[model samples]
Target: MFQQFRYFKPIITISLIMLISGLIISCGSTSSIPIPATPTKEVEVAVVPPPTPTTPAVPTSVPAILAPDDSCVNCHSDEVQLLLTSATEEVEVELSEGEG
Candidate 1:
């Protein structure tokens, strides 16, 4: 038993020394390697021209359009009537008529 322990003691000490040296080398300061510069090749991109503009086709059939009427206020007024008079001192705000 004593002879076997004596033989293994040197082997264990060498293994521990190697492991500690590996750890110390791995934990050293990190340095970045410089990369060699190379010339970049020019890349050609394909550009497509826009299509020629053309006059739009006119409507074959006329669409039925809604005619403006004052009767729409009967249900949309929320039962509240707003009176507008020329002599009234309230703020007058009127929407401009559309050309369409």
Candidate 2:
């Protein structure tokens, strides 16, 4: 009989442990101490006026040209133009080849 129920021992132990834990968790202390409410005094606060907003200085005009010493203008201007030209040529060749 013990040999036949040996496999069920761990399951039964775990179930019993879970059942006791659930009962212990459900039987928590319900009694709470009553807290006395503190009396609040009326506080006098000085009202402050909102500060006036000042207008930000607007730029009269934006310069059309970038600064001459700008590195991006120097480095990318020619490379970007070359890339655009090559891409345009590729599209033109593809169009011509398709037509022919």
Candidate 3:
């Protein structure tokens, strides 16, 4: 029994050491190799190009009337109103010489 115990002790110690080493190696980072302290160099800023003159700026004297919506309701306001109230609905207001 003593002889068996002596022979098995060294084998158990060696097996435990191998298991721990294998576990540590497997758990370590697969992507990177760890290197000691080194400072990185700074990059210089690049100069931007100035804007070139092309088209003239539009005058504010001109009354810029922007169209209302994305749809045709901007130009046809009367048609939109008529469509909203069914086909039979009548509008009594009389239009002036140039108006609809």
Candidate 4:
């Protein structure tokens, strides 16, 4: 039994040495070091003046030049006016016939 235990003595000695070294390394001092301050630079800034206010021009009359035939102005103005006039005439004719 003593002969069999002799072979494990070197292995146990190596394991104990590694464990002690690891403990000593982990338990060492952990002091904080001071950092140096950086120098500041001066910057130049330009001041701008505010813009002056002006009156906007207002139109007193419509322009003599007409818009193109395919423009939305023709569709909204001419087409809508024709439909309104025809609808009023039809309503007037129906009222006259009903009265007769």
Clashing pairs in 1: none
| lDDT of prediction 2 | 0.69
Tell me the deviation in Å of residue 71 in model 4: 64
lDDT per residue (tens digit) for residues 1-100 in model 4: 8877798889989999999997787667343334455767677677544444664555556555764454766546797676876544443344454454
Give the top-scoring candidate (lDDT): 3
Give candidate 2 misplaced runs (Cα > 4 Å): 29-100
State the C-alpha lDDT per candidate: 0.68, 0.69, 0.72, 0.66
lDDT of 3 by residue, 1-100 (tens): 9999999999999999999998888779564656666887688777544544765555446445664445766546787676786567587887667856
Per-prediction backbone clash count: 0, 0, 0, 0
TM-score for every candidate vs. truth? 0.29, 0.28, 0.29, 0.28
Residue pair clashes in candidate 3 = none
- 1-100: candidate 2 lDDT, tens digit per residue: 8986898899999999999997777666344535567889889898654454775555556575866566855546698776765644443334454454
